[model samples]
Target: MTARPVIALDAMGGDSGPAAVIAGAELARERYPKLLFRFYGDETAIRAELARAPRVGAEAVVVHTATQVLGTDKPSQVIRRGRGTSMGLAIEAVKAGEAQALVSAGNTGALMSMAYLALRTMEGINRPALAALLPTLKNDSVVLDLGANVECDAENLIQFAVMGAAFARVVLGVERPRVALLNIGEEELKGTEELKEAAMLLRAVDLPMRFEGFVEGDKIGQGNVDVIVTDGFSGNIALKTAEGTGKLVTGLLAEAFKTSWLTRLGYLLSRGALRALRAHLDPNAHNGAVLLGLNGIVVKSHGGASVRGIANAIGVAHDLVVADVARKISDDLANFHAHRPAAVDLTSAK
Candidate 1:
């Protein structure tokens, strides 16, 4: 039997509080039976939720925290005074090897800050990038620098491609995943110097992934590429736009179906397909966003995530731990550095 993976949870992180965190753990327990948890938060609240989820309680150990990181708190504040907070304690568990991974539904900035400071970056990684699976027409695509470093340069984007490809290989189970840099146009001369430089270096490097040059924003959902790399500014905007579009399309569909008897009948006929679509677009299915390039595995769950969403986040952490994604990333980065042409300068011009 495979060894159980222990995960640390920031029980006081999300908007729904400890109850949702525990409930989500219970749900994850059902999916991954060989999972263990270390919950960090208010003992009383955690115990209360655990009582309602005895199965999860059976596999959980709660560590009480006197304070918790607030959504409004800045990243710097959390880094300086957050050691005692629930989020801080949870990350500490991972850093200390008490847990293989950490799953937090707290402030993104705070999570990133603490994880970065505690775990630090990997040997070849300049900065950690936020990566997540985006639903697409063909299959899920991994997009990185979602909001981690807003002003990344060519070297950063190149590193993101390497990291993102490794993530795709592990999570998506793709061999030689198709990688591309997000650009304004597919043409080589269309994007900024950073993108052009990144693309040039990526093509020169003999990496594990298949570099597919550049792709436009419209091609993201088309799923022609397995990994999309960009600076955090553009990547974050693309992510938000995709999310908003999914919501808008779903909302419009609901309103359209309720317009008349004819539409209602049409909806009834296509109910199954509609449900599938809804499931495909559900943020809960893609709840976890990983802070890649960190020394330890850290997954960020949406603040407003439901129990199911939180469970998915935990599942993502479990997958990363079991697959040893960090090791794969390190190996790939080492290969890239070894094979990179001497003429290519990886320094950031910004």
Candidate 2:
């Protein structure tokens, strides 16, 4: 890790374009005073936003590019003809060692495709998983395979656990984080043969994490586990459901509070508590989702994220770079393979 880490930004990404991207960079700069930036986008638009944020402008170097990835662009299309685009150039900065990490609010599929193609997966990692921090009752829990690998085998799940545990150590400040597989029921035999085999292998290994048996959907918010492992199919659905439920609850509360004068008075009295709840439920607070197992770091911010949310996403990139999370993951994976149990054959298990 360097004293000052430079982040590559796809300045033309997201719904608000350079305005939100530059504003977010300014906020991130305030949080991390030693951070620097390389902004890639239309020079005129990027410079226009930078003018309003003198502090960030002083620390940023703009690279002009008229091309930008669209929300509707397919990953295959980007892979074939995206090198000149802002997103592609930003990713290239990381691969070329000019930037420590890349942050983009562009299309998720496109970003993943570009990153995987440019950076490739780390050695010993068969696939890269999308991991994010989810707010929980005790603290934030790391959930992986959010939308990267739809189908996974026992070996893939085990690898996700190792990578996810490394992420928790760096981001969540948890030592020997507890890990579990997401399944329909808590019973040992409830999930598929792949999951049960993965659990058995995890239990047998002497890894840096504590392998909790299993976790159900209802228990995700309980915060009993530090890392939750699942295939992208299940993990993505769980993430979307949680987001929808949060909005539903907040909307219902707003309507109830506006029903009558008595309720209005009650709302005024509970304003402080409501504000606290709002902060917890804010998606911006947990904006950055990393594509783990890549040689270089790549963080995906929500396209519709606000300035604060985008800043938080940048903050995630900064922290991961400073902590040297990629190296930690590499080291852990090496340790796992070196000490792998001779009796367990991943091929046979699969």
Candidate 3:
């Protein structure tokens, strides 16, 4: 653990191109002085941005030239013949043991495809899920399958629960994290057949988490639960809804503050609190979306994330790598299989 972590960067993938990636790496170095980086993209452009930050120039950053992948490229196409692209080479660095993790602010589907194809899934994972840390009333909670697999059966849902619980344990440091399935109502009779079946499966297994039956949509941000599990179709919708609502509330507050001189004075009086609120609701603060269940760590940042946002994404990758999340997931799955009731068939109901 004493050795510095090396992060591979896909410098040419995002909306802002290599400039934002380089700037973000510079900012990350300030926080992690010993952190190393491998910049995969056009060397000339990477160097140009590197020159802009003197402090970063002094750090250990190796430039690796790569053919850029366009946003218009499809996942299927990328998986077949995009190995030489910046995103592809970044993932290759992790697979080749050259870097601890890979971070990209690029096309979500393409990143997932490349990561899966390159690093492959962990032992027990059928498919990797997209997980995001959502801000809640009490604290942030982990939500999975943000947009990875649209359709999931009972077995897939159960796997997501285990993965999500491990994520909360590592990232949130909850000893016995509370895991819940997202449903229409809290009652056992509610939800589709898949939800009910998944619930039955979780209850039968002696997993490390506390499986709290079912949680409704409104409770997602309450922080009463540490992890929320759902299909990608539902999880993705909920994520976008929450993000949109946050932006709407922020805009309303800003407009309200500018309404009158008295309101403006009130805003001035509450400047400190407002600053705290801004920081709390900042999308950039939670820019990293982790691709779970993969053998190697892959973090996807928003395509339009700012410099600080990109730095935050890097921090997510760094934390997951340090926590050895993949190994923990493997261990947990091993326990699940060993402790599961003999009559219970995990392959059933799917």
- lDDT scores in order: 0.92, 0.93, 0.88
Best by lDDT: 2
lDDT of 1 by residue, 181-213 (tens): 998899776888888888878898788899999
Please count the clashing residue pairs in each candidate, in the order shown: 0, 0, 0
Q: For model 3, what is the alpha-carbon lDDT of residue 218?
A: 94
Q: For candidate 3, lDDT tens digit of each residue in 285-322? A: 88899999988899999999999999999888888887
Better of 2 and 3 by TM-score: 2
Lowest summed lDDT across 10 adjacent residues in model 3 is found at 341-350
lDDT of 2 at 17: 94
Against the true structure, candidate 2 reaches a TM-score of 0.96
Runs of candidate 2 exceeding 4 Å displacement: 345-350
1 versus 2: better lDDT goes to:
2
lDDT per residue for candidate 2 within 1-350, as digits (tens), equals 68999999999999999999999999999999998999999999898899999889986899999899999999999999999999999999999999999999999999999999999999989999999998888899999999999999988998999999999998889999999999988877688888988888888878889999899999998899999999999999999998898899899999999999999999999999999988998999999999999999999999999999999999999999999988888888888878777765435433
Q: Using Cα atoms with residue i matched to residue i, what is each candidate's TM-score against the true structure? A: 0.95, 0.96, 0.93
